[model samples]
Target chain A: MTLERAVAPAQRAVDILGGDVSESALKGYLEGLPGVDAVGLEQRAAGLGTRSIKTSSKAWALDRIIELIDLTTLEGADTPGKVRSLVAKALVPDASDLTTPRVAAVCVYGDMVPHAVEALGAAHGDPDQGLVSVAAVATAFPSGRASRAVKLADTRDAVAAGADEIDMVIDRGAFLSGRWGQVFDEIVAVKDACRKADGGYAHLKVILETGELNTYDNVRRASVLAILAGGDFIKTSTGKVSPAATLPVTLLMLETVRDWHRWTGEKIGVKPAGGIRTSKDAIKYLVTVAETLGEEWLVPHLFRYGASSLLNDVLLQRQKLTTGRYSGPSYVTID
Target chain B: MTRLTVPKTYKLYLGGKFPRSESGRTYEVATPAGEFLANASLASRKDARDAVVAARGATGGWAGATAYNRGQVLYRVAEVLEGRHAQFVDEIVAQEGVSRAAATAQVDEAIDRWVWYAGWCDKYAQVAGNANPVAGPYFNISAPEPTGVVAVIAPQDSSLLGLVSAVAPALVTGNTVVVVASERFPLSAISLGEVLATSDVPGGVVNVLTGSPAEIAPWLASHQDVDALDLVGAGELDWPALEQAAAESVTRVSWPEQGPDAATPSIERIRAFTETKTVWHTKSLL
Candidate 1:
């Protein structure tokens, strides 16, 4: 093989990688590139086959889809059976061959917080280890249609039951009606209630229910409104809307959180919920947070996917990579 | 004569009450002089949310106010800050750990930056914006509107100047801001916050939080409520990643060129805070 032939393959490889180059064309292009060195061309061909830019793009898209499961699973409507199944799987030990993205939290109804706590407790102590410790539909959650007093009490109850975090929904009805003050006051009361419990308190994640909010512009405004309303984290969708946790919505929230952190010297968290169900989907969100907020929020503390059942796929992928052998679904432990 | 000694602690500037960090978490503030000035709040993520609620509760009339009223309110802030010029000098000096003279210069620039932004409240739309020439004849013009809530990372070195420069533009354009001044110089930012509160600029419009940038910025960056982000003071950020995360919602990001002096600021900085929209409504013959 000649040097000119060797160089030709790399040239063809670059062309095939550009845009919509078909697979066969890419193969043909790789074969023809005049890379004079046979071993080098073969190595290059393998590298191109496995390490394409599209692979990273695909990984990112996968991450976002994985994130949707949590975004779409509304706690108020979740059955006890569903919660138990999630808890059992989350508590699975990491030492096993089963690979799982630690369930960030098992969001449940306020009435269900104790059940989740008990289930998580039975699995193990160290609240965050075996479980993420979540209480959803917080003070006026699902609907901010309650009195401030009632909502505050709701928050208090959830936190007292060992909920490490509270996912509270804002009154989008009031917000859309331009009653910003009412919406603001409701969030404040809930935040105060969270603090009164346990000396300081559980993380308060404000669910904007963006689908109801309407408009990207409104979503942006609501995001700012929720954060300023004392939300420790701002999440999209209660998983009950027609359009729950879109990529654009999560991205906007991430940007808002980033800007807020810079100006105030305070850290906030972001969770994208609804419809996520693949390893590929989870990675997109990881990439989104990684790109938007830096590497700091890559962990469960600041970044989480409100998911269910997506772990199996994530595990399967991790397993495949480690052993270089595809395994049966049962071989990977989801629970 | 005993030498005057400086105190070494920062209290939470909440509702005019200067309380110790409620979380009891404290971190050191390093000055340009290569010394630790004081131990300030390592505000937890919870504290940040608390501040947001405060800001949100206060945004009703703050953002809904008539432009004229809003301008007047902002102008009053500049006046109040002017009246307390000496206090700012003292705070900036201690926070930045600079000589009184240099601190005075920085303070003057910071104060002036507010005045500059204050003036923009009444006229920014006319300058950076205009009526668009449309092909189909209908009154068509695009103007800039506030993007609602904004989060800022004030500059690290110029403390007061950088903080003022980043903050003023955001608020002046009617966007409520949650600012994180340099952890190295919270006193000045807090002092500025005090002046704004007294100036009647509204409570949550400009909530100030202080802690570690590395810890807090990612949270803010990824936060869902924040509409836009200003990185003027973000020294070395991973732009690609930051933009990627922001791309999810296409959050507006401002990466303006760094101003000359650490403390000297500019009007161009406000460009990061505004957006232009041209709405077209067409009526067809029945």
Candidate 2:
């Protein structure tokens, strides 16, 4: 309860929620936000998915998607070798064609950040500056079940390891059980932990793990809380759970971000990590973003796709466009 | 009240699921007498690409199965086909404008062809493989392994029999297939797809595409993942160009001139899609 009051920045949201920054106050604020129009939200997402992007526009979307991708490899089996290769792919997504733009970042487990950083070499930095950033999944990632001290340490260690961005999964148990204060404070602390030796903080992406959150309303609330808690981006999943990053959920998150932008005059990014495997699927996300957040959020720093296999599919599509013939997996590197 | 005579929508079978063409284009398949049959998916190059992906994905499991297991799985397909015998017979009669007796004969032959290929699954390796004669202190043996995904363009004239003949042999050797059904007569081929889906044949092991061979064939020929191309059905299309495309990928090409008596099941068809793998086993620990 004290942690909820301790967060000074979320006071921006506190004013709208109630007179105070109490746990009950924020809970009421979230619960009071209009319940999701389930059918309408879904219909809008599906309608956006049907937009026909082709020819030059398709070529453009494919290249833009490559730039917006957070090329990720998160597994128990992930080795330094795997991180290096992932970084290499992020640097040069298609070896066959040098014209292919690099991905925004290479996402890895916090421990593998150094390898990604080393592999990226001089090319590592802000994606907006034409360099691929290294994003580390921290704070007991894929499941935020660790203590507060360990979670903060994980984030700081990743920043120390040269991660330019931290992808943190929120404690769903706290968020689901209505301990809104604890969830909000943890995100604030994780955001604080992103500070580097130079005092500049790494970008923080808070994963809601919407598949476990159980409802569109919860996803919207979590997205709003993450944004108010100083998350630079509100991500949809850790890519560990089933039903991750479906169109409707992403649409809901995008709407929250859109609404936040409308109220605060600041844009919060949304990254839909899992199940977005094909170039076609990624393009649908692009269409949704363009329609919701306008053309500017389409940039690498403002928007991103957290994916591993999606790059290869984009490469295959690129090859198809270039050669006027369908390319196969043999043409692209195996993830 | 009159009962509705519902027609089955013929879609392309890709990775064991029936999907309309990615191009969203369907061509009207007419009977030999010019009567209109159902619209068949005019599978574009994209659908062929998808089919190859499915076929390639199925290769590891299908090829690694014991020869006896493959035979049993294929025989299960025949069992399913036997149950749906009347459907294939009716479609064949309608599409080919053939006599009910002739259509029934064709359907029966198609089922028998599957059984024959199924039986050969356990025996083809024995007939095709050999004990290598190499000068070494080792037992050198040559075994036949499925070449990988085989792209077969079914004969346009004899839809069901030709498709069964071309595809079954490739499958018996554990090679997954992406067979293009006859553009003009695709009914029986799709019914066969239903049989495979209901049987033990794994999804992606046999992707049946119904479209223009000329449009879909070149993509499969040049696809690096496709290990072999059987163009026996490519007699009507510009087949030599397909062979040229297949040559670029180093994919083995099989374009034997099929006779007018319809496709005769051949051991060579099976041989055409199997790679000879030689292994040197140490005679004893030195």
Candidate 3:
């Protein structure tokens, strides 16, 4: 079977649950989800973190990591100029080296989506060449404290502004208060908001803010909840909290995707944003994905790093591998 | 009554923590008379890479410190070393096969050398920096700045004194180091790590790895993150090949003068691991 044929089942599973499930039914489905063994999960992730990837494999992983990056800049000081520069970086990561792959997407705040869309569109003149996607974080990101109507509008504004992906944050207060149904509905609503007027829709990435969820069981439940509520991807954090995107947390999420695939035949992407600043850390996440989920999930569509400085380090390592000499931060753009 | 003797594990000092080499390989260090001293971590290329990373991470903080503050931190190292004088003297005696008096003298000199370099921390810039008189309508000034991370091959013969002489200048000038300690007498170097950890020198500012210079030096020499290399302790290793490897990264290579002059302290040693940055600004008449 072709790749598209294989992916059809997963899309169909998502379509079948489109905004129709009741709150108690969602609660029953999420509560029935298996609990995560914290210590065992942490130990397994630590063990896999020691996997030695070297030389050719290291180079390959670096290149693949560049492609999987959601080159992000979510700051209060974000401007149109900054977004345009970031978009240019996403289009041509390393101008000195033409072989460097473009990043998976350029992630910005919902307000900056139009700047990214325009910049990316201008960079890639030919539509056949596959322009970089613009991913915008919405739903009162990092906090998820806004009302449902406001959250839905935030996501809709980004999609209408031409963002190809919507990264919405789940209400941690609801998830922590055992209001799992409310959290599920919020994701469902945000996913609905991702649909553009042209019938095309942006892929929805649900941010669990696992750092605030406070337990591996909650992380697992949130994972299953997001996937069921039509999240195209499940992200660990909003990159605003401490203890964001740890190895064990990512491992638990990857396992969720693995089991989700087994039961529903649907594939969901995993993104571990924040505190992952080095190339080694990026490769370790890739190792986790490959070992936990399988090689199929290693692609950009399945894995992503919501990181900003990580790209420069990857570029430096790539240059060192290719030229047998290290390149400094001065050699790369500061996006 | 029989007693159970617990020997110390001589681990590599990276990022201010004593960790066994990531490779988990160690080689036995014995006295000249063939009595086993301890198992020293046989550091691999990966350890060197880690040290470089640590040094790179530390460069910003260390270099950003005020010269007076850096001087105080270096002086603190001497203060810690003075308290641990006897321990270092005993290790030097066992490792270098020196007399009690000679070992004591070596430890004294090492401490004194550290003190000497500590004073130079705030003085090197004044002595080496200059205000150049450019003919154009601009004010130009030149001053010395650290060359970031440096890789050092600590002198082999005088383990304690040589190690101190090689390391003090680099630390004093605010350039963090990855020093390959004396292979035959690594105990003193590992013990020095104890003093440094307690001192305010900051972790990764002076990383010491006790392993073969031949095994670990090449990795340090080739490391792209390392900005300079001091081959004072390279001993009889193939210096030319290491220099060639260093050239790959355009790393500034420093080979101490041969014979007695090598032991002499000078501003040149500090300048070797420093980059002279000159800034020009337009002198506008308002």
- Residue lDDT tens for model 2, A15-91: 56655767887787788889999999999999999988869999999999999999999999999998888888888
CA lDDT of B223 in candidate 2? 82
The sequence of per-residue lDDT tens digits that candidate 1 reaches over residues B1-286 is 9989978466555443455555689888766666766777777655555554455555565657766777788778878878998887877776666789997887777767777777777787788777666777465767777776676777866667788877888876678777777767777777777787687776678877777665666656555456787766776556555555555445677763365654244556666667787776554545
Tens digit per residue, CA lDDT, model 3, B214-237 = 988887887767899999877579
Candidate 2 lDDT at B218 equals: 84
Accuracy of chain B in candidate 3 (TM-score): 0.95
Model 1: how far residue A335 lies from native, Å: 37
Q: Return the interface RMSD of model 1.
A: 16.6
**Candidate 1: regions farther than 4 A off:** A1-335, B1-9, B13-22, B30-36, B56-60, B135-137, B237-240, B256-259, B262-267, B280-286
Better of 1 and 2 by TM-score: 2
Ranking by lDDT: 2, 3, 1
What docking class should model 2 receive? medium
Per-residue CA lDDT of model 1 for A117-234, tens digit only, reads 6777654332334334554567666766788788888888887777666788888888787666566567666776776333655677788998897665566666666665567778
By summed lDDT, the worst window of 10 consecutive residues in model 1 chain B runs over B256-265
Query: Which tens-of-lDDT digit does each residue in A282-332 have in candidate 3?
Result: 989999998988888877678889999999999988988988654566678
lDDT of 1 at B249: 46
The ten-residue window of minimal lDDT in model 3 chain A covers A1-10
Local distance difference test scores for all models: 0.64, 0.87, 0.84
Tens-digit lDDT string for candidate 2 (B49-93): 889989989999999999999999999988888888888888888
What ordering of candidates by TM-score runs from best to worst? 2, 3, 1
Candidate 1 vs. true structure, TM-score: 0.45
